[model samples]
Target: MGHDKLLVLTDQVAVSLATIWEAIKVVRKEGFEKLDPLIITQASSDCLLFEEPSSTDDIICVCKSFEFPGDKLLANIYGVLKPGGTILVYLASEPPKGQTMQSPLERKLLLSGFLDVQTSESSQSLAIVGKKPSWNIGSSFSIKKSTPVLPKVNFDDDMDLIDEDSLLTEEDLKKPQLPLGDCEVDRTRKACKNCTCGRAEEEEKVLKLGLTVDQLDNPQSACGNCGLGDAFRCSTCPYKGLPTFKLGEKVTLTGSFLAADI
Candidate 1:
């Protein structure tokens, strides 16, 4: 029977070779053909630098023997493997305290684009198995184009199509009448901070009137209609609730008027 091709990769030559030899013996005893193992010592280079891509049938890596990053090593191994080829990584030692090796190994294998990645943990060692996809890397094939079939619409000549314009009345069609002013008052009847509609100036005058006791006692009417009560009083008139009096009469505000609403 022809021998199955296998590639044994390791950084620690003596220990890894011994381990591989023991595994080979086990396989032979299980009624399998002898493995033609090609041993390769891992180099310092980022890649394994195999002469031909997709040439190796199977690869075995002694993970505990690696000195460099496992990702770089796995990426190189993936390129060397033929389509549907499998890789077996043997980790002889457990990971750091409280951490498992299975998750990290599975992640690295998946990131390297290996398919059907699996991890098994034994009492002595952990083994990670991953397979290259059936399709070769860099190979491309055209996707089959599909045409969509749209649902057919049937129009009845007897049925009249409703006019959208006929549904709207003259009131609904007319443009809404918006209040004509540069400054719009909010729901609270208060103007914005930077009022453009002269409310800021009125507020400033009201503030000034409140500050000056003389102005509050002897009020001056700007429109000459302040004595006509609130109906004729200007928007910012201080004596809004005051009774109609002579223009020269001094308006004395009551305790109720002086007290705030809060």
Candidate 2:
């Protein structure tokens, strides 16, 4: 470990800077003259801190105070760790307070090409440690196309017994329908996607409001009335029952609705 270089990935640098400072001191005391670590405080969706393969011997990821996708972060970390290098993730996990993530963290690390995955508990934090196998890292882990293996499910039911009536046909899909009511249903399921009794056009209207509908929706701006972007709303205005006005349409301001109460 002493021969390998060190790197740190964190969003809350203010909270973890002290720990990192001590780590650097330890590295320097161990006679590693090149103690300058690559510190990454931020990353983008399309780009991560490391653009190339693993060059560092160890990478420490501090995620106790922040929320992030575990698998994606592990994938990025695995890509930048040298073969046989170590990765240590420090996170908040207090099971007594009903918060526990050690199991999931260990599973993710193992699936992300890291070997010897283990977890330890401290006062208010959980430490996850894994090592990249010393084997050819490139052949074992292709960071560009790395994907976690999903657990396989075993069912005793017969496949032929499945019902198909609930499924929507091609013609039904071609026809427009209205949106569904406020139901806590997962739309990604086949059963939900096949629903057609509801108005499909209404759903299309709502979806189009947030998406591009021929220059009508702008993602960069917020609504003047609600101050929320279109992505979080179905309408630009919430005053129900009011007659909608179109651009260039005119109405007399002397209407009874605006008459002063005497």
Candidate 3:
């Protein structure tokens, strides 16, 4: 919708127009009146761009009933798109017989250098949309081929030695031991031998329990913000126990999308 002109690619313009009629009506209803969309069904029509690499702002390709190689068309569209341009693809909810692209179109777009790829399904089709990155794909990344530097270690033979001659004297041992028990009471600067109440003991206990600095007061199983556990996940978190995405991996959506796919 940010585009001044949108290019629509499809195998049959007439057929696609019929399929997306309702969507077109919705777009019109939303007060977008100046959409002079150019429809194309052939790669030869790319000559219309006059050799400009990134002239268009948005390209919407409808491949739900397309018979051509979708990958080739997508690559072509990617080449013609401007930086931060949008690419929206309409794919069939179900793959045609013998097609290997059964995975969600969103995965393919993301791996192809598009950002923020999203997918939504209608009663009859699936729509995938993505944006071209403003920066070069690998511009911010670099790998240095150099050997790692390790710290020089020095070992002392007497490191574990316990000197009995240097042990505490009777007079030194007779010094009164500080009282400790409740954390609320006895706020001593040094450790109490009895209850082990001190900053050092607390830090040691935390480290022994494998807790992070932030987790010193709150654990991971519980929300850091609201302090809620598994019984109630924070409304803001997207932590559903599903597997992470791998490009072109086959997946099946459940709930409402599943019904639409069926």
Candidate 4:
């Protein structure tokens, strides 16, 4: 069989050397050519720094009397592991007070993008297993673009089922006729409160033509309907609702017309 490389990570060098020795014996008994087991101390920050990336086929983390590996260490381990490689985290001692070993290690493994994470507990130690994915990092593949299929509709068939005459009632079919009258209360087009319908425009023009003392003394009508009473006055007549008078007669505006409504 082909030789395989293994990584043994631990805080204690004695434990890691023992594990490597056992692994070597097992590999030799199994008739392997060689078992190159590398030991990385957890206390050293650059433990995996000298190792080639994605070179190790398997990793055994011996966590005895030491805290579980953190994210950075786990990431370094993942970087060193070959694609489809497996990692076994063996906790030889119980985690610190009020803390768990398996779950947090599993979460950290998953966060580091390990796959098929699992945990098993024994009387002496807890073992967490995870595998690196078969695909290498930074590898890219094209995703086929898909066009959604829309249901077909026939407008001609749909139009034949609809009855145009049945859609309207007698009231809806009837055209409304505007009432014929000069300022009928019900027929009068009421302006909006903001006077957006141009109704106040005429009033504004009338106010702009300020009634000076001379103009008040000798009132003149542009449309000759200023003193013809409300009935005969134009819609915008300033003298509307006033009594009829001669063309040159002075017209007095009432208090109602002078004072604006609140």
Give stretches of model 4 more than 4 Å off.
Answer: 16-36, 152-160, 179-262
Task: Give lDDT tens digits, candidate 2, residues 1-262.
Answer: 3455788766553546566654444324565455567777653222365446877778777664434335677777677777888887766445445656777767777887888887767776667778888876446545697689999998776655646765867887686755664322434322236556443443454354543323222222233222232344445345223454332223234478777899
lDDT of 1 by residue, 55-110 (tens): 87777776564333367778888888889988877766766677666776778789
* lDDT of each candidate versus the true structure: 0.68, 0.58, 0.57, 0.67
For model 1 the TM-score comes to 0.52
Candidate 4 per-residue C-alpha lDDT over 54-90 given as tens digits, one digit per residue, 9 for 90 to 100: 9888887777644446567788888988999888777
Off by over 4 Å in 2: 1-3, 21-34, 42-47, 65-69, 92-96, 137-262
Residue 155's C-alpha lDDT in candidate 1?
93
Candidate 1 deviant stretches above 4 angstroms: 1-3, 16-31, 41-51, 65-69, 156-160, 170-262
Best by lDDT: 1
Q: RMSD to the native, candidate 4?
A: 12.5
Could you tell me every candidate's TM-score relative to the true structure? 0.52, 0.43, 0.42, 0.59
Choose the strongest candidate by TM-score: 4
* lDDT measured at residue 168 in model 1 versus the true structure, 0 to 100: 96
